[model samples]
Target: MPREISLCDIKGLVGSELGVSAWFTVDQSMVDSFADATNDHQFIHVDPERAAAETSYGGTIAHGFLTLSLLSAMNFDCLPRVREQQMGINYGFEKVRFMTPVKTGSRVRGRFTMAEARFRGPSMVMTTYAVTVEIENERKPALTARWMTLIQFDPKDRPSET
Candidate 1:
């Protein structure tokens, strides 16, 4: 479960492992959808038969971006939730590494640790998390990234347009 903490408390939570997310299965449909969305229809990602006969993985695999996109779901499951949070948005990734291919029909989960958190304004908190996407039953993780989220404490506390 996600931890409930105030915006003021985020500074103290840096370097702490928040929690692990529930496993999410990546099926062929998901891979196909991702391929359609990204216009990447590589044989290794969308063609199961050719993948089985030609590739060492022996099956279709999900795109690295597809796996990376699951970060939002993972954060909801096992990260700190700021109390009185009005809204939140992804800031961007500082770093990303696709370590292993995630084969279709495999399950993956994320491990999250607070990397840094700071107050950007009176009602805005900027938090960064070191996230590892682990493949079920696999020795190496599928991907790792530095994920950032901008948490807004109030609806009107947004950046001014100059």
Candidate 2:
């Protein structure tokens, strides 16, 4: 089930584990599609045989950015939602480190920790999540990032300051 909470209460969650998302498969087809979409046809990402012979990774690997992009879908499953919110949008990333290659056919999931949360305005909340994209059963994670999001709350739900 989805985690539900009031936007006003989110600030209290800083420094706590938010949640972990469900595992997602990173198949070669998806890798090829991402390559087509982004035009990042690097051999390691789109060419299997050549990648196997050329790189240490052994076979085609998912692009680093592809793993990064999956964070959004993972967030949908595990991130908390405001009771009266319009929507949340990507604010930016503080940092991102690709520590391991996610080979094609690997499964990945994101573990999220609430890094920080604060009121941006009367009805806007800004939150940062320390996220790790883990490759299934791998000692090293695919990537780690500090991602920020802007949540727009309904004006009626805004808390009044004392």
Candidate 3:
């Protein structure tokens, strides 16, 4: 688990590794739910029998976006709260690649490293994470993303808001 960190702590370690999230499993239920939400009922993602017979993956697999969505929960698990900041926004992503299939029943976790952090006046623009979602027992990663976040804070407290 990552230690609880304030905005100040992040500033001090601007170009350093920050944290990693605990492992989370991708099961059939999750896949089914994602399929329902996205209306992507591709056999490889939702139909186990057809996938087993037709696809190289051997069974139902998770949708790529489903795997990407894991970032939200994963980040929450890994990143400590910025007490002084009112909120943080999902600024954008620099790069995102899905390297391998995430088969149903496999476990995945994210490892985050801070790439860069810059103060944009009252707000901090942080290109902070190179998140790799690794599959348990698999050689390749399920997804890799360079994610950015904007942390907004009060200027009056800048000195104390590291």
Candidate 4:
């Protein structure tokens, strides 16, 4: 379940951990589907047999983008939702580093920290999260990124100036 946060309080929570998502398995079928959707049928991602022989991973691995794209669902699973916001948009990532390959059948989840939050306008707030995607039983994380999101709300909902 997503936690609820008042838009007025977001800035106060900077540098705090928002939440951690539940584990999600990245299996071959999902990888294959992602490959089909994105046309990234590289052997390391789609061909288990060949990948086992050719790569150090021992089997097919998920594409870096596929793993990165899981952030949307993970966000919904663990991040807080702004109580007064009508919608939120992906503003994109400032930085992304794929440190470890996510092998097929690996379970991964996201850990989010509120790195920064500032009001862009009366109706919009720009938030940056320091994110880490951890693979189960792995010493190193699959990836780390600085993600940005734009939250839009009614201007009338803004708190009165003191």
Best-performing candidate as measured by lDDT:
4
Q: Arrange candidates by TM-score, highest first: which order?
A: 4, 2, 3, 1
Residue 69 lDDT in model 4? 98
- Candidate 3: regions farther than 4 A off: 160-162
| Model 2 C-alpha lDDT per residue in residues 19-129, reported as the tens digit of each score | 999999999999999999999999999889999999998999999999999999999988777788898889999999999999999999999999988787677888899
Q: What would the per-residue lDDT of candidate 1 be over residues 56-161, giving only the tens digit for each residue?
A: 9988899999999988898888876777688898999999999999999999999998999877766777889999999999999999999998888774643343
Per-residue lDDT of model 3, residues 38-149, tens digit only? 9999889888999999988889989999999999999888877777677789988899999999999999998888877777776564646888999999999999999998
lDDT of 4 by residue, 33-79 (tens): 99999998998998899999998989999999999999999999999
Clashes of 2: 0
Evaluate residue 127 in candidate 2 and report its C-alpha lDDT on the 0 to 100 scale. 87
The clash numbers for all candidates, in the given order, read 0, 0, 2, 0
Best by TM-score: 4
In candidate 2, what residue range of length 10 has the lowest lDDT sum? 153-162
Off by over 4 Å in 2: none
User: What TM-score does prediction 1 earn?
Assistant: 0.91
